[model samples]
Every structure is written in C-alpha cells, then in structure tokens.
Target: MIPLTLGEVARVTGGQVHPGSPGTEDLRVTGPVVTDSREAGPGALYVARRGEVADGHDFVDAAARRGALAALTNRVVEGLPCVVVPEDPDRLSARPDRPPYDAVTRAFAALGREVVDRCAAAGGLRVVGITGSSGKTSTKDLLAQVLPALGPTLAPEASYNSEVGVPLTVCRLTEDTAYLVAEMGASGAGHIAHLTAIAPPQVAVVLNVGSAHLGEFGSRAAIMEAKSELVQGLVPDGLAVLNGDDEALVETMGGRARDVGARVVLVGLGERADLRATEVVTDERGRATFTLTAPGLGAPEPGLRVALQLVGVHHVGNALAVAAVAHEWGMPWEQIAASLAAATPRSRWRMEVTEREDGVTVVNDAYNANPESMRAALQSLAAMRRAEGRTLAVVGGMLELGADSDAEHAGVGALAARLGVDHLLTVGEVARPAATAYQQGGGARVSSVADRHEARALLEEELRAGDVVLLKSSRDSGLRVLGDELAGVTD
Candidate 1:
C-alpha cells in the first residue's frame, strides 16, 4: 500500500485516530492491509470486522502481537492504537440474507478507494476490472501472470472478488505498480457497481454470463444486467472487452459500453469477434493450441499461435481475453503469446490435474461448480481419457441452483453417460438425482454414496492403473478437500 499516516487514514475513512501512545497519529502504515490476524505484520493495519460467527475486534491484541501498527475498528481497543469508525445504525436491522457491510468494512472500503485514487493520480497505474458468471479467477490468474511482463501487476490472492476482497486487493497498490486486475463478482444487483466504484477500471472485461448464480439473480437476463455494471462504470475513453461467442452478452454489453462511450473489443472463437481464435485443437492432455487473429488491431504477420499449459478447452476463451488486454496495452504479440504459453494454473482446484505413481490421473476441478463449468470439466475429463483407460467422475451436489437443482444435477449425469464415462459415483442425498439419471441413461456403472467417505472407499476399491478420475462440485459440498486428499496433497 502507498504509505499513509494514521491521521491520513482517519481523515480518508471519516474516522478518528485513538492513540495507544504519544504521537501515534503520525505513525505511517507501509505494509499490507489485512483482515485476518495471522497475516498481520510490521506496519500493517488490521481491519476489525463483525462477521456471522466472530467479531474481528477480539483479534486486535493478536494482530498487535504480530507487529501490526494499529487497528481499524468500530470501537476502541484498550491497548492497540485504533482508527475508530462508527458502526452503521441500520446494521442491526439489516436483512438476514444480505451481505454484512458494517461500518468498519465500509471504512476499509473507503481507505481502499483513497489509496487507488492516490496511486492513479501519481501516474502509470492502469486498473482492469474483470467480471463474469464463471472463468473470472482463471482469467484473472492468467492476466496476473501475463501482465507483469509489461510492468508490476497486483491481483487478488485467491477468489477475493467480494466487497472486502476488492478493497483488500486495491489497498496493496504501491506507487510503481503498473496494473491492478480487479476480479468482480456479484450475487445480486449493485454488487459489481459498488466494487467498480472502489477501483474504477480503464478497461473492463465481461466474460460470458451463465447460470452460476441463477437462484440469486432469478434469471440469466438479470445476471447479464448485474454483470453489465462493470462496463457501465467505465469512463468515456475506457475499453470494454466482451465475449463475442455469447450473443446475449455481445448485444447487452455492447450497448452498455456505447451508453458509457467506452470503446469495445469482442473476443471469442467465432468469426464475428474483433479478436478470434482459429485452428483450435486440444492435445490428449486436454490443453488447447489455437491461432489468435485480431485483424482489427493491426497484426504484424499471419497471427500468433498460443498454446496453453492450463487444462480444458474452456480456457481458450480465457486466453483470448488476456491477449486482447495485452494488445490494447501495446504489448508485442510475440511477447503476449510467449507469456500465455509459459503460464500455468496458479489458482487451485479448477481443472487441477495430478498423476499418481500407478498411472492414474486425477482431475480436481471441485473448487466451485455451475452447469456451465461442470459440463466443461466433464468434457475435458472425457478428452483426457487414456486410450485403454476407463473414465470415472465423482461428482457432488451443485448448491444454490434453487428450483432447477434436481434437473441440473440430472443433466450432468446424462452428459456423463453420453460421454461414455465408465463409472459414475454421486455423493450425498442432494446428488441422488444425478445417480438416478446416470443409471437410467445406461452404458455405465453408477453408484450413489452418502458422503465423501463412501465415495473415497468406492474409488479406492474400483480405480485401476489406467483409469482417469474427475472430482467436481460447488465449494460448500466439500469435494475440493476430498480431491486434495485423494491426490495426496498435504497442506
């Protein structure tokens, strides 16, 4: 973070500095801003937030013990220097379903906005905001890897796309930082808009809109409206990169960009795209190799060929988005291609592949799942099946699907059967619909397990040397942790 004195932080956040010692208001914060006490270090300002389970105020002493300079809290801490931001009066009556955006969180968000404004005014900082139903993290990871070749780039640590997460990411900016990749996520209207206000992007990339959060937004059209907020937040000279293959997005987002007077670039595998991919092919390992063409952007030669190290053909769209951003920034096509080709999966549990000593391959894509990504992972799993090996898919229930939950799960099972998967193991009562569908579809051995324990036991008994297995589900289903255990990953 750009160094800020306690007094400066208090003024920016509309708080008052309560000194633990004399002259504390003049002390400078030069380290990372964190919410978790364990991550606190010298010069760190720990944000004391009230969560559903615990209050961050209780951890002020823990943070101070770990070298934190002060705390940003709703109330004063006895021993720790604090920037006291008052709690919102309406917080006590907030709806049970809404996200908790209390006073301290809002104040922390203000501090993040202040830091970003200061950094941009100092020059050379270009903020890029990315939003979509799926692929946000994958694309953010890819851009974080590729953009640094141009200059210093800072992206969120993991899937930090929420209100607090966006601020946490923005506050990390230093004076020399050249790029900020803000991955924006939304469960309802105005979530993206609020995040965009914190770090307004010069470039906004809206990936495809799907059924990832259909329950929350009620419909795909509503989801599109929420995702379009990023483009709507752009300034007149800003750019909007959209997925051309998704006609719905192209129509809606293109209009939004025009309304905001921002320039637009469409990226996809289709011919209508300004930046499109050709000669796309995936190797036996399910990695994609494609030729990227952007005739509209003034290419030097025939076009660049990009080979991705990340698994799955779905990543081809993500790669094109990255290439478009780099090209807009005037990065050499050769450098962009090389950087993309050299990049690997930095984030965990999304199409993360592991090979056992006995030749069995495990595809751990259980980070989070919706119908779109679940289908994509299954397709890659089928593609990566060894010539003589059986393909196995251990799937858990996809949560937050609302009324369509059963049908969605059934569709996944039917897809597995049609893809010629040799075995289907569905875990939990919520996933029983999938097992029923898979059995009815035939041509495969299907089993239903009550939990991950039974599923693991079944796999341990049935998995063979040449078999390839895939684990997929939403984050709350616990399938990601089970995948880690199955793959012998210890942390």
Candidate 2:
C-alpha cells in the first residue's frame, strides 16, 4: 500500500464515510489490505464481505482490536472507521439470491485497481499477467523464482486466479514492490479481461489452449477466445508471449494479438518460433535437458543449454516462455537458463516426487487435471519407469469436461495402457470409464474403487517395495491426500 487516506479510499471505491467511523479524513491505511480479519495488523484495512459460511462484518471489532486501521464494508461498525459502499436495491430485487455483501466486493476490486494504478504511475511496479488452461500455476511458479532475482516479486500462493483472488493478489503490492506476477484463469470469456482491468499488465504470457474448462466454454475455440483475453488486455506497447506449439493458439490468437497492438513472441519447439527449444531429452528422473534458442538478438550467441529441475519434459516449452519474458525485460540468457535450472516445484501436488526410505517412489500430480495434462503426466511416468520396475497410476475423475467427459476419461486410460503402466487404479465412480476402457483395450491389470479409502486399501495390499506410484486427478478427487499418505508426508 502507498498510504491512502480514508477519504481517498471512499472516493476511489465509490463509498462514503460513515458517521460512526472512528477516524477523520486524514487517517490513512499504510499496511496491507486483507479480506480476512485475522490478517489485519497495524495500519491495515480489513475488507468485510458476506460469504457462504459467515459474514465478515461480524469480525470488525476483532480486526480493530488486532490493530486494523479501518474497515471497508457494506455496512458500518459503530466504533470503527469504515468506508461503506451503498448497495443497489434494484440489483437486490432483481437477483434475490445474490449475496448482500457483493457491493463490498465490487468496491474492493475498485480499490485494488486504484492502488495498482497509483504504484505503476509512481514507476515502482510492473504487472506480468499469465493465462492458460493447464500450466498457469506451474509457469507462474517458474516466473516467480526468476522475477524475484530482478526485484521484489509477489504472486498468488496457489491456484488463486478467480475474480476475488486477482484483487486479493493486487492488494498485496507495496510501495517498493517491483514485480507483480498474476496467474489469470478463466472458465469463460471476460473473466481474464475483468482481472486485467484491476491490475493491467505490461507483459502477458498465454501458455496453451486446452480442454481444462471444456464443459464451461463448450469447445477448444471458446477456450482459446477466453485465454486470449489476457493478451488482448495488455497495455499499449506491451508484449505477448505465446506457445507456438498449440495450433489453436497460433492460428486463432495471432490475429487477436496483432489487433491488441502488442508485440508478439512465439515460444515452443517449432522451428519458426521466436523463442524455441531443440535437442530436447528427459533424463532418468523425467527432468528435461534442452537447447534454448532465442534468434535475432544482436549478441554473437543465440543458444543456451538448459537442464530444468522440473520433472516433466513438457516443461521445456514452459521454460521457453519464461525465458522470452525475461529476455524482453533484458535478463541475460545465461541468467534465465540458470534460474530455470535452479527452480523446482514450489506449489505442492503437481509433479511433487518423493522417494521414501523403503525404496518406494511417489509422484503426486493431483492438484487438478484435464485430458492434455493427464496424458502429459502419464508420459512422464512412463519415461521414469525402468524395464524391471513396476508403474502404478492412481487416477481420479477429470471434472468440468461437459459432454465429452466420458470419452476424455477413456482416452486417458488408453494413453496409460499405450505407455505400458503396469497397473491402472481408477478411483471414484466418475473415473470408472478409465478402468473399463483400459480393460477393453487389453491393458494387463486394472482396478476401480469407489473412494479414496478403498483405493488406499487396494494399493497398500498390492504395492511392492520398488514400485513407483503416480497419483493424479482433479483437485476435488482427494488423490493428493492419498499420495501424501502413501509417502508419509504430513503436510
């Protein structure tokens, strides 16, 4: 925060100072802006909203006692300095099911936009926005590590890419903050656009267009349109880094990127890409080693060899995208390569590998899932298995896939069979299609369980000492918990 006064907050959020408020116009918020009252501290502003479980307005006094400077709320607290945003009675009547505290959320977004604009105008902050179907979190984690080497950087802790999550991330920016890496995700059009309005970006990275939200958007074309919004919302003179290997992105999004008037840099394994990888190979642990080439630079050398600490060979493209962004910002090729090689998975349950003392290896990639990412994980698992070693895949349902859900699930099973996984353990009723497909496809061994408990029981009985187990599924499937349990990891 850059020290905005209560009066300024009221003005920016279309709010009014309440008569019961404790402070005058000059009382300012100098600490971080937080939605949870428990995060409030000296000079902090607590934003209160009515949620499904509880109303945040009830915590105003607690926040004040905890050293909060004031409350930004839909209604005022008697002893608290508050900025109250008026509710729309028309909206309330039109949509009776809408939460009454939505007015406060709208105001909070506006406040975040104001603060980001203020910081950018002061020449102290640059916002980098990234969007994609599957790799948003992974690539954001990659950039988070590299960007911090340039300056103080802030990014979302996990998959905090929703509307509220975007504003919450923006509110974390400070006066001396140099970089804000925002991971933008969308299930439909206009979601990323709205997030961009809150914290506009100077550099935008669109990783890929995939089937992650096919149910919501209806088709790959629709998903492409949604993901392209990130680049379309870029500031004037901004740069767009795109995945050239994705046909949907290259064909459909190239014109959109041009229309947005942003300089575009294509990144992938394609020979025509501005930033591309070649001579790619994955080692025994499924880590990738590639020759990264950024052509047309004035320097004598245009290629750099990179061996990523990340597990999947698919991450070569991700590293290329990160290198393009860092390159645009003037980071040397050697620095970018070194930073990428030094980076590992910071977010849990996405290719998190653990080798127990008993010689059993566990791979947890259950953060979320889709057809593309499921196939990628299966391929990586196949690469890690030795001729004498057994491989078991504990998979769950991939949700939000709409009408093609069953077919997609079956395809994942077929891929696992093609990759020669020794055992295919499909967890939950929704994922039974995978087991059926694998059995019908002549896959050697398969099992289906109704829940995590049954899956864990069967695995405990079947798993061998030297076997490698891969746990993969959508987040709601609870496969990550089972993976951690099998690995004896507490947190």
Candidate 3:
C-alpha cells in the first residue's frame, strides 16, 4: 500500500483528527482488523467493531499493547488517543466515516483501497463476486479453487461477506491477483450495492435466493433485490450468471439487467438454463454427484459428474455456478471439469459428518442459516436417515431476520417435522417456535433447550449409538459449539 500522510487520509475520507494537528508522516498499512491482539502488526490499524455481547472498544487497551499504531473509537485509550467516532454502527462500520471513526481507520482503509485501486486502475480487476442467501460460501469456495488453474484468484475466508469484509478484501488485493472471488452477503439494503461497487466484478454470480435475512430485507422480493445488486453493479461488458430455476431472480435480471450492460448466463437444471445439469445422482453419503450440461458451450453429450464433498444434494447448483464462472473466464472445458471435480469445500459446519462411537453419523452443519439452507440441510438428513438409522436434528435460531424471525423459525420446525426426523432438539429462544411447530406438525419426539451447551449436555446423555444427527443453526447461536462438542465426544 502507498503510505499516506494523516492529512491525505483526512482529505480522502473527511475524518476528524485528534490532537487538532496533522502530520505528513506516512504509514504503510496492510491487513484487516481482527480482535485478537496477536494479529495486529507494527503498522496495523485497529477498529473496535461492536457486537451484541462484546464491544471491541473494551479491547482497545489490549490492542494498543499489541503494537496497534492507531485505535478507531469514541472513547479514550491510555496510550493511544482515540479517533472519536460519530457512532453509527452501519456507516462507522463501513469506510470509517469521520466525526465518524478515528482518522487511523479511514487512513487504513484509504491505504488498502489505494493498493487494490492501483492494481485495477490500468484496465480493471477481473473480479467475480457471488451473492445469494444459500450458496455464497460454497460458490465462492468453488470459484476460488477452479479459477486458480486459469489465473491467480483470491476469495474471502469463510462467510466474510459484509460491509467491513468487502472493503477489507479489496484492500488486500495485489496486482498479481487475476480473480477476486468475493461472497457478498447482506442483511438490509445498500450493502450489496456498496460491496458490489467496491469489487466491480466482471462476472457476478447470483447463486439462488432463499429465506436468508428475510427479517432484515422484509420479504423475499426485498432479498432478491438486495442480492441482485451484485449483478446490477457489474461493470461494462460484465456477465451475470443467474439461476434459471430462480423465478424471482431470472425475471428480475431478464427484466432489468438487459437494460444495463450485464450479459446474462443462466445456470440451473431447468431446460432453459444456459448452463444446465442432467443425470444428477446422490451417493449413499448424501454427496451430490452431478453431470453439468452447459448448453452455453456446446456438445451436450456427456456432463461432468465429479463427487462433491459437501453433504447436500442442493449444492449441485453451487457446483454448476462455479463451473459457469470458470467457463466465463475462458478456462477450457476439460480443465473446468477437472478443477471443479477436484475441488473440495472448506469445512466449517456445512454438512460435516463425524462418526461417533457405536454407529452414529454426526452431520455437523452448524454454520450460519436462513430458511433455504435449513430446508436443504433437513432434506439431506431425511435422505440419509434411512437404513433404519434415526435422524436427529439439533437446530438453533436464525438471526438478523427482523419481524419475520419467529415465522422463519416456525418454518424450520415445520420442515423438520415434515422431513420425519426421528428426534428434534431446538436451541435458543427463537428456535422454541420451531420446536413447537415440529411437534404440532406430527414430527418425531421434539425437545427444546435454552442454549447450545444445554443441547450438548442433553445430547451427551441422550444420543444413542445408531442415530444420524444433523446440527444446524445461525452463527450467533454458536452452532460450532455443538460441532466441537460432538467432535470432542463422538470420537
């Protein structure tokens, strides 16, 4: 990054400087803000992001002790003068506005953007951002793996798809990067637009719209609109890889993106899909092995049927989207097939199976959630629960879903019941409704818990040797706790 003077940062981001004086001293900065002081470096800028339970400002002293050059905050630090913030979570969260966040934060962002902008300044960054309720992480992982064979690629770690994450990824970009595969996730409006504007991908993939943050966006239509921002914000000569089966997105892109410069590439099993799938099969392990028939290219004879690692039949769609992105980048068909066929999803909670003692299968997919992902995981369990193995669902509440949160939780419960899960254990207050709905929906024995620890405590005692369990929930519920708990005991 080009070292910027404190004055240049103020000029660029219009932030307030403390001590009422400015220095031309330049600080070359890199890296995104992580709370752990150990990650902070000599020139690191620390941002105090506020969450429900923990306020990062509380850690500023710890941050300063770790060699943080500057701390962005509203309060004071003993060693470092705070960059007083205007204190809006969303905006201060973004590019660090002044009167806003501390000058260091803006300066840091400016430095990072300067680096990425410099790389893309000559022509453009061959960026391809993906945003959808269900398949973002999977799709991003797929593209990063497949595109590298064609060119150097960089995608965010896990689901780092947010206001702060997008800019941070942009700042991380070096000229050597040929593909920046970003997953753009949002709660309300403007985020997708903001992030999409930052990446300005040449090819934007809208995987599939699902009941993700319905509470935040208000409705499915709103979610669709928010997700569409990725494709809509595409640069001139950009390609929009759409899901042909997603009626909401297909109609919207077909209706509007044509007016913009975006070139549409439809991907789905539907016959109308530009990149279609055929002869899809799921193995005994619940991993989808599909043959991709992309009419967009030609010769529909044999589709690609690689063994997908992620444990969901629905992820066939995600694989297809990655194939589309690889194809769009001019990667040869055989190479695309090889890259995708060889690709393995980075494991967290998505369909992670652990074999506990006795004969149980632990389907540990305790990551973030929306209605669509919940249904997909449940379906995975339903399909695998057979062989006389009991299907157990350990579910937690989904967050950030505004007013629709309760109904969405209820919907999850209903889905679990309809899937005929052997046992349902709902954790968190929001998931109580789902538990209730599951019982009412003629589901198998339904149980409720106050939190994940309680659920684990019960599972430790109740889980039998021959059951197939599915643990799923939102990030806030800390579903990983269950995964770790199961991982610890299942062995």
Q: Record all residue pairs in model 3 with backbone atoms less than 3 Å apart, i.e. clashing.
A: 83-102, 215-401, 215-402, 349-365
- TM-score, candidate number 3: 0.86
Report the number of backbone clashes for model 3: 4
lDDT of 1 by residue, 142-207 (tens): 999999988999999899998889999999898888899999999887778878889999899998
| Deviation (Å) of 104 in candidate 1 | 0.9
Distance from true location, Cα of 38 in model 3, Å? 4.4
Instruction: Name model 2 segments beyond 4 Å from true.
Output: 20-22, 89-101, 298-302
lDDT tens per residue, model 2, 230-251: 8888988899888888766876
Q: What is the C-alpha RMSD of each candidate to the true structure, in Å?
A: 1.9, 2.7, 4.1
* Per-model CA lDDT versus the true structure: 0.90, 0.85, 0.73
The candidate that wins on lDDT is: 1
TM-score of 2: 0.94
Model 3 agreement with the true structure over 355-460: per-residue lDDT tens digits: 8676778888877887888888999988786575788999988887788788888998898888889899998898899988899999979889898778878888
